[model samples]
Target: MLKKLFGLTASFAALVGLPAGAWAQTAKDADPAIWVVKDADTTIYLFGTVHVLKPGLSWFDEGVKAAFDKSDEVVLEMIEPDAATMQGVIIKAGLSMTGPGLSEKLPKESLPALAVAAKDLGMPESALERFEPWLAAMMSAMAPLSKYC
Candidate 1:
């Protein structure tokens, strides 16, 4: 009885722990496009990817497998950084320091809109003001999408 209960509990946990949208689409059915360039001495292939995948998506099938087998290297848009290097980058990017703040630097006319938007998202305007506009915008855009991964 204990063993059966343990097995059921394990299965439940595994199902719950899977990423959201894990069963949305299989690679075989999803038509992702790839660009290829080939010549006598060189071959290049480019494919867009979401950078994460569910466990069962057989994406590297047949043609992709062949191309990967022939390729000497795979290049990614951004290499994964180690923890220390990432921390150093965050510090260098001015995220760690408390300065004059993002409100002061923004044109006086924009502050109200910024505050309203921040409030709508359940974030304090000051929390976002520390980062540059581009970074702040990117973070806001990514907030919803981050949960899936």
Candidate 2:
């Protein structure tokens, strides 16, 4: 399973035109985890993902690449919204217009962590207060990953 996953990763890297030696280490040096579930008519491969990773970490190889090549479909969990539409949606759904702000709604103990995270993201705590809790949490989680991308 690991070998198959390596092949898939290698295939993706190769497809994207990365130089063979550009990665920090060869795929043989890495052992990424992969799992397969098979049923009567379908099979699923599951692998862990960090969503964003710094460049130069190589774990793709021929085995995984072969499995990837033979696969009929690939699924991804993301949606790309147009900038204006996305902004409108965020404003409509992610903002707290008249009620209590985020800090007021959050548990007292969580406020300090929220403040720290907001600061780390270079956002003022007040700015985060304008967001609904779910949006604020999502932003807090994703903001720190921007530097890696």
Candidate 3:
């Protein structure tokens, strides 16, 4: 029947969508570690690095240093994401501390989990109460991601 064909098509679309969504969550070429792999004549070194280096100490791997010193140009994720850009994204991403902010945007169910995690770390919830829920969620997510970023 026509109904059966429509159901099959919808199911197929749902199956195809998951990978695309996962890919969207990850950085395509942004990982710093991938540059370490081999290939071209112009060697691109992505130095694996510690998340937090001790004061006055650094791990500049030879290959990475060579690439940096040899290269005529350097680029970062952005020239700078200055105040205006930050404010704009805060507005757009709903990171504002006031109004509905990130609080209303998030599923109500996740709040208890967030509170528990913050408390477990001894990170006071009261201090963070004014922060937008989106920002809080990001801080929670990004804590583990510091190494990757």
Candidate 4:
């Protein structure tokens, strides 16, 4: 299945005039990765996506475009929520319901580092107290990447 997908991708790349070394290039110059899964009853091609591209970046061509054009059904990871609705959902689901605050749950030594990171991200350290640990960590992880979007 993998070899067949690669053969099709390579053939399509040639058809579209991409250089043979296209696959060997760095990510900045190459297409995103994709995977194919097949059984007797169904075939699924999974696209690895960044969801948003930097302005002026162009990737929706060649093998990616060909796969999309040939797909029988398209499934997306999400339907984007409106800001207000999204905020409400996060408040409802992403907060600690009845546990020790985030700071209290952490080792005493880690609190200072967490506070520093939160402040550097322009988030009040106290605000993290209301979050579930996973949500807080996710927010911290995603903060730096927000500028890209």
Candidate closest to the true structure, highest lDDT: 4
Across 74-96, the per-residue lDDT of candidate 2 in tens digits comes to 77554535544555565578776
Q: What are the runs in model 2 whose C-alpha is more than 4 Å off?
A: 1-33, 59-63, 82-88
**In candidate 3, which residue ranges exceed 4 Å CA deviation?**
1-58, 78-97, 120-129, 141-149
**Which has the higher TM-score value, candidate number 3 or candidate number 4?**
4
TM agreement with the true structure for every prediction: 0.56, 0.62, 0.42, 0.66
- Residue 92 error for model 4, in Å? 1.2
lDDT of 4 by residue, 1-149 (tens): 33432332233222223222333223344477879999998888998865434444456558887888889999977665654455556556766658788898878988887887677556668766766766666566555544543
Q: Which has the higher lDDT value, candidate number 3 or candidate number 4?
A: 4
Find the 10 residues in a row with the least total lDDT in model 2: 9-18
Please state the error at residue 63 of candidate 4 in Å: 1.3
Cα shift from native, residue 127, model 3 (Å): 5.3
Q: Candidate 3: lDDT over CA atoms?
A: 0.45
**CA lDDT scores, all candidates in order:** 0.55, 0.59, 0.45, 0.60
Q: How much does each candidate deviate from the true structure in C-alpha RMSD?
A: 10.9, 11.4, 17.6, 14.6
Q: What are the clash counts of all predictions, listed in order?
A: 0, 7, 1, 0
Root mean square deviation (Cα) for candidate 2: 11.4
Span of 10 residues, lowest total lDDT, candidate 3: 12-21
- What order do candidates take by TM-score, descending? 4, 2, 1, 3
